[model samples]
Target chain A: MNRLFVFCEGPDDIRFFEGVLKSELREGYASVELIAYAGMKHIRVDGFIRGIGAMGDDYLMVADIDSDRTVKAKKNRLKRWYRELDTDKVIIVIKEIEGWYLAGLNDHASRSLGLRPLPGTDRITKERFNRMIPDHYVSRIDLMIEIIKRYSIKVAREKNRSFRFFYWKCLE
Target chain B: MRIKQVSCRNFKSFSDLTVDLDEYNILIGTNAAGKTNFIRIFRFFRDIARHGLGNAISLQGGAEYIRNIRISSDVPTEIGIIFENELGVFSGVRDTRGGSHTLSFHQIEYRFSLQIEEGGYRILEDFLRISCSCTPDLGEGESGQGELRITHTEDGVFYELSTPEGIAIEITEIIPPYLQKNVPRSGTLLIENPLLVPMPGFQRFFAEIAIYDFDPRTPRKAIPLSGRSDLEEDGSNLAIVLKGILADPEKKRRLSNLMTELLPFVQDIDVRKFMDSSIYFTVTERYGDEHPLPSSVISDGTVNVINLICALYFDEKPFIVIEEPEKNVHPYLIARVVSMFGDAARNKQILITTHNPGVVRHADIEDILLISRDSAGYSIITKPARREEVRTFLKNEVGIEELYIQNLLGL
Candidate 1:
């Protein structure tokens, strides 16, 4: 199995990709060893990317839209960002990671929290979504992991175009 | 007596993190990244010196918390520290432990591997040895820093003594009797023994080391206490220490003068007789113009600063491990404290763990040990100056603190 370094935003992103995503991706592909490169260090991203590239491990990444909605717009605006960071594959979560979590929220999980099922295509507002979470300190990724397990990948893909493309890329 | 390097195995968050020590060290990391645990490694030794091994292990949640959960080893947890003896050369290498010497300084290395059993943790191998330096204590016996070696066995149960003229092994005769008499507060038996007095190289080095942590609440309690030169973990002796310093006209004046620099108050520090014969103080305002501040009523920051200043001045503990000097003080005040520690480190080796950016920014890059948790949830430590990229950045910049404020310290 190849040693794949999956670069994500934070510990939460790492937990989602490594703990949940990899657990579901174990059908045929080699397990990925996730490395969370918090883009907070914006100036040193290129240096860190270059350092990881020199490590010989294939780099896969996921970045949040943070502000921009389109990937091309983000790339155009963040021209100074290390665009060549991804060696194998890369994807962006629209608006923020909450949209991906909302896309994967099933009825049972939504009802468990006294909430109705969210439309697969709907963009999640951080304020509205965080209202359902009673404990703020608990890992939002772990909570999403439980909800995503029962989520229809087909429905999530249909609602979230970016997540859908990323999901297909994972199988590929 | 400077700690050149330390390598720890199976310590919390660190499977193996070895880094060289600097005069002024700032151990910085995100919350729960085990910066405190890394500092505990030094505290563990201090506890052993103050209390025993059993008490030290129990204080930090026992051996289970100490052993790195990643390793399932049948062997014991290991920690090795190396320093240069007075006559040993600074090899700055792990392997050269009193083996080969080119300088007058004798290299000394102490390794302790503790194994936890049903009852308590057992110290496996802990011994101190110096590079061949013959002290003239052997009756005007031709002492010219010659090939006189004081080596201890791997079990720490024996000493392998060798001189340029002779060689002697003390497994049964001298070693057993001395160790039997020792109370075992530390891993090694080198505190203050007549046998060790013959060669003061290793003995003096270990004795000068001291660790302290002052609790702010201690100064608030009205307790009567006597002062000593060495300050306790909590500033329980705040009033007593003040009283002791106040007794000495020169030292008392110096304390008030230094306080003026750190804290601006036109008042004096007074210690009065409290209620009982315990650690408490009574703050009263009886004077007309000059309101003398008692230790109990002093602000938390003022008390902490006073304890720190007293520790630096009176306590001659060459190797001092202070937890967080940045506590209870303004950031600007903390910056002054950091510089004071920097000066203190010049005379005595000081290791500090802090969340203060003032310390990180003001301290030299070589002194910063940036600690971070890896993907496996283990802590890794690195000196920013040791890295070429960070060194390149520092070459162009005036402010290193901005590296941290900009969230670039993880490098």
Candidate 2:
């Protein structure tokens, strides 16, 4: 069976992708497996791509924009490490995965989580996400789990530009 | 005999877990992920066989410590083991015609469940089943299928053996006289009278399963001369075991060579006996004018390494479990220590739990079991090599230590 191996940066990014792609990817692929590389700097991009290609399995590399100014610049940065890296297979999250998480919430879901409804989340950072978390949640992972349940891919694509691009490129 | 598989339900942190074990197993997990609890299962069985079920439960700090906290009192704590008998101890059975037949079973499975009662726990169910192939000992050996099952339910303990002709017969009379009277209500019947069991190999196998949670300080103390040759769980009897090893010229030379190889400064390792007849292991160093350093003066890591060597090489146990082999050892020597475990695993099944990335770096991906906790706080075990994604990363020459550090391999 053809398997989809999605490599994300960290646990938060994995949680987001698992919430979004878990059911959606199963239609075309037998199973979807997620690998959290923890950080972008740790990945051996060239070897990872080559190895996955050798296995004849589809993979998506998810990364946060971080300090990179544009998605094109981010792709170029990754290409410097691996020239043969398929830039089209790379999905760049605007700011961070936390932003994509917040982008999924509508007004009711946002209010339920004790946060304001966020119309756009392209500029959201981890620090901003932490500060916005309500005092009721036990920990960051706790809130992430609750947010994933109410997450809406439709709302996420509409509220975040990078997520919209990811929807068009990978999902749709 | 080697344990092929283990299953536990409502036992400590494992609500329900079943894992197939290889010859060598390296368990990696964070604190409170139930690695220690998993290791305790072997010791629990060993204590039950050597001691009694009540004593085994008491040794683990009573019934509260045995059952999972999440589970209710009514739910029974179950443990099952499947063993591959290597010695073929029970290889023959007498037929109905008074003829001997060569009987061989591929595997023996034993399972028991205990329910937590008011004062303590009682055996809810005990089951043992062996499926065997029988070949006539006479001319023209033709194989026939048969099965033997022993179960202890509320009604009473019963033994049922099916002949090669597929005729079922009650063989409860075969149970020893001592076992019939001692049909334990609060203890396991199999453990209470292991010798009386149809297949007696499992009792010896269970009794010899050694678990070492070495205390480096205990080995540093002087141990009185005793007949105990086997290394103790806490390594309290290291000096005695070492004395036995050193008595053999060949084994002594090998021990000296291994110690020197692991600890470069070590010249030789020898036993020192005092006037009181108590003995301690001394390490003679090559550096700074050779002088023998008593175990008390030796570093904790060095003592731990010595204890590990004795536990892995000198011990006669068929299965061994060591907790945190990298406890105090230097990072540079972790690979060598892990390799020693691999070498020892060739003959006997070895399982070691470690948090060190160096151990993971040197270990085969197939031998490593990742233990993680679910959201509900139940322990889960998974093999990284079984995952296609982990295999891909490994194929790319990406070190497992990196994957472990990155929490990429299912933390």
Candidate 3:
């Protein structure tokens, strides 16, 4: 049986994805086990599979790409990283949540995308963007998901188009 | 195959010490007592000799100059690991504050001495002497500036040559097969101190020795719930390693069988990339249903176990080193896990460091390393006598936890 594994950086990512995306993955991943890892180093799921069980070709790693340094440097590092990758078994998602939040569409972005801000948030914000522009239209989470899907196809070469961005809940 | 002897000086907590290793060795020491440092010497020698001087020094916490000598004494510290090699006997020595020397088989010994000068420590004197077990000879009138004289000897004939000039002198040459590769590089001057010197010959020998630390830091995310080997440091290549294993059906079934033994609840693993290009590991249960065991849902213990099993079972041939194997694991499972390692380590040499008595009690005492510190500031690594001391202590009023806490076996 082929299993799909998901590793989220934090607990909130786990709860939000499992709670919201359950319906979409339910049938497609009938024999799949979904788990959320809190940190990068805490899990050795690949090593576990090597000895007794096998790891499926499908894997997803999610992390927040907050701040300018994270957005530019991390993505660049990940871009160069693709050269060494097999490109057929894994997908990496870098969320520019902070980029979306600071662009004047803070509350609507949060509510529409289901993104939970770091610790001190009381509730989803109702703030709205006063000015709409082409700059704002580009680089949204929805567009990011689409780009990731296309990028994955170039690398993984999987024929199935059923794959969805692990952080797709942000687009809801 | 076995460690014949270990001599240490001014290394960490040990000021000076020499200990022999028997078939069954025990190293007993108190907490903060340099026992770990004693075990670390093997790693130090293995790493330095295997990886080269640069890597060894870097791995041992690089500090530019490793002036590791006796704290209060003027005596330069030295450590020599004497072991039996296939050709014959060899002793690799490192003087933390002195020089690097090697005693090889063909009755030839190379010694490079260090002199602390204003610029930096320089090689004041170097010698390539011969010692044919029955006799020793220190060559006479050998004076040269910035040149390493290598003498290859064979059948009582010595052929000596200088580095840059390549001037050959007729001393006597018994050039064994190993000495053929002794080519000197002239442009860069090799450092005098052992810390900066490279041992090409020792490295050749050390490659046969394998050491696996099984560090929990081997990025857990790299382990696909269903995969073969692990990824590189950042676990970025996990996808590649997984795909390599999944391409074959026989190997996948082998993985399934092993998983059944370790994680009974794990029926199977399903891996896939969503249309978005993100990869995920989904686990199937014994029941028909399955779900993804998000990298987060798994516990640390499960991750560590999986890492160990993967490295042990997946690699071609391996030598394993484990630290605190009992961490995050249930006490009841310690015996079972140890037994599994014991069985797996049947053909491999295994070195483990642990504070868990459960781990110790479960294994044969012969494999236990009883490390402890003595009053002289030297770490004394000795096995517990066959006497009833350790056994009686285990059966006595104190439990394993208290025994360690009360400083019974030191550390």
Candidate 4:
């Protein structure tokens, strides 16, 4: 039941992005659900946070600066709620930004520059990453995928490692 | 066969409004409160979205006539309808927003933008979205916005629309292997058909869609001899339909039986055309002498019944829309007519708009709607009469006739 959901501002956004991503990702990823609502003015982080119950799995959500309201406040509020509710279950991305800046980070291009250095994850190659980053047509989905993969691995590693094993080995 | 919701903006008497719906919508408001206008707007948007910009716009007299006579262009002329498809469940929601959002339920979302330009109305944009989902957590799947994914079958294409953006990559391509060879014809979603929005291959994609207005003035004509059968908006081709029915005696017998059950007076339909200018039909009675009933001489009630039957029995469309079904029909038959619609709608989506209390009362309360007007000049559609304060008046103080009179008088 672990499904991925992508929310866009308009129907065209949903259509265009899905078309582009479906070609890049494998068949399983093609089933990712995209929802589009027009003239939507709210950035309620809880809408996505509350959405996790139905997913029963991890989620990667992307929202853009469609409203004139405080992007930072909205982003921070959502991040706080998501971390409070399910720390590793949600990933929020905001685009159409003046510059790419993931919340809680000060460096501009370190992650946002659309670089993929990891091996075996050619799925998010640097070329495709750079290709999707510049224009307003669609945000860098490759990078979005990368961020999701990284968090997914981190969550898995933390979950699988046991501290008692190290203590038991030292005592023996 | 119910209108579940309606929203209107910059339309006749509405500036901006949204109303939820029920099985039978009893649109009540003071005189000139915009009930019929609200109803017509639903069909108008549907016509434009299902058909195309040209057809949708043409129905309101003309482009010039479609412009809001009372409001400015600053407010877009808009309307939306939410109703049950063939199933007892709600199926889709449509609006004039130039965008559509499909839900996980067996529903579709359509939107169009209408604006006044150079003293005429023009569609700025149009979109049609349908919903699909699998068993476990289909809600997320159904909320997709994308091009409809189609499975071309022997009968027709089986369409599954992802979110308007298109299908995602994560979900396994679950279609049968036999259906994999067909390549999607690109730009198919942008074509305009007279009956539906510009979805590629409309006939192949949505041949199951039908519309019946129950109008007696100009009934729908049937396809000619040995022609493919289709339900016309007006019930004109009753003879052609009869001919088609007669050609297949098995189906003809079933039609005869259904007719007998519904209308005991009807024996069998006589198919004929006169003067090459008009097609006419007569009813053969079981006991008395047979008589010709000129298409013109036939009562509106009979014409409406024939039209409803053509839509219910003959047509194979998956979606059927009925407007003002109570018009010209006897109140006692409304329940039977609704039951027939329900039976026919088993495999298709059925949408209806009406204001008759007899019709409303016979329907399950969940199917009833109370359409009212708000101060902001919007039409507010709601369900479960008990939810609204105005419902009390209908439940206690006034009769349906008074409600109808008050609604027309804009009291």
In order, the first chain's TM-score in every candidate is 0.75, 0.92, 0.40, 0.35
* Local error of candidate 4 at residue A101 (angstroms): 71
Docking class of 1: incorrect
lDDT of 4 at A143: 31
| Model 4 misplacement above 4 A | A1-172, B1-8, B19-32, B45-51, B62-70, B77-108, B120-210, B215-228, B273-279, B290-299, B384-411
User: Best-fitting candidate, measured by lDDT?
Assistant: 2
lDDT of 1 by residue, B1-411 (tens): 678888888887788879888776778877888888787777776665555566667888987787876677565788877775364332211111222222244666666677755555666756565554444332343433433233333333345544445323232322346553334334443333325423334555554566667898776676645456457767666766666778887576566545554664435666677555654433333352555655556678877887887776656676777777778887645545665675456457788877777677656677788888888888888776777767666666534677776656666
Write candidate 3's Cα lDDT for A48-129 as tens digits: 3342234443444454544425434654554353332222333333332222222222333433434332222211121221
Q: lDDT rank, highest first?
A: 2, 1, 4, 3
Winner by TM-score between candidate 2 and candidate 1: 2
TM per model?
A: 0.58, 0.67, 0.48, 0.48
Worst 10-residue stretch by lDDT in candidate 1 chain A? Answer: A134-143
**lDDT-superior candidate, 1 or 4:** 1
Clashing pairs in 2: none
Q: Top TM-score: which candidate number?
A: 2
Over B306-402, each residue of candidate 3 has an lDDT whose tens digit, in order, gives: 5555544444433344555556666655655555565455334455667676665455555555666576555556555343666676554344334
**lDDT for each of the candidates?**
0.62, 0.79, 0.42, 0.47
- Candidate 3 positional error at A151, Å: 50
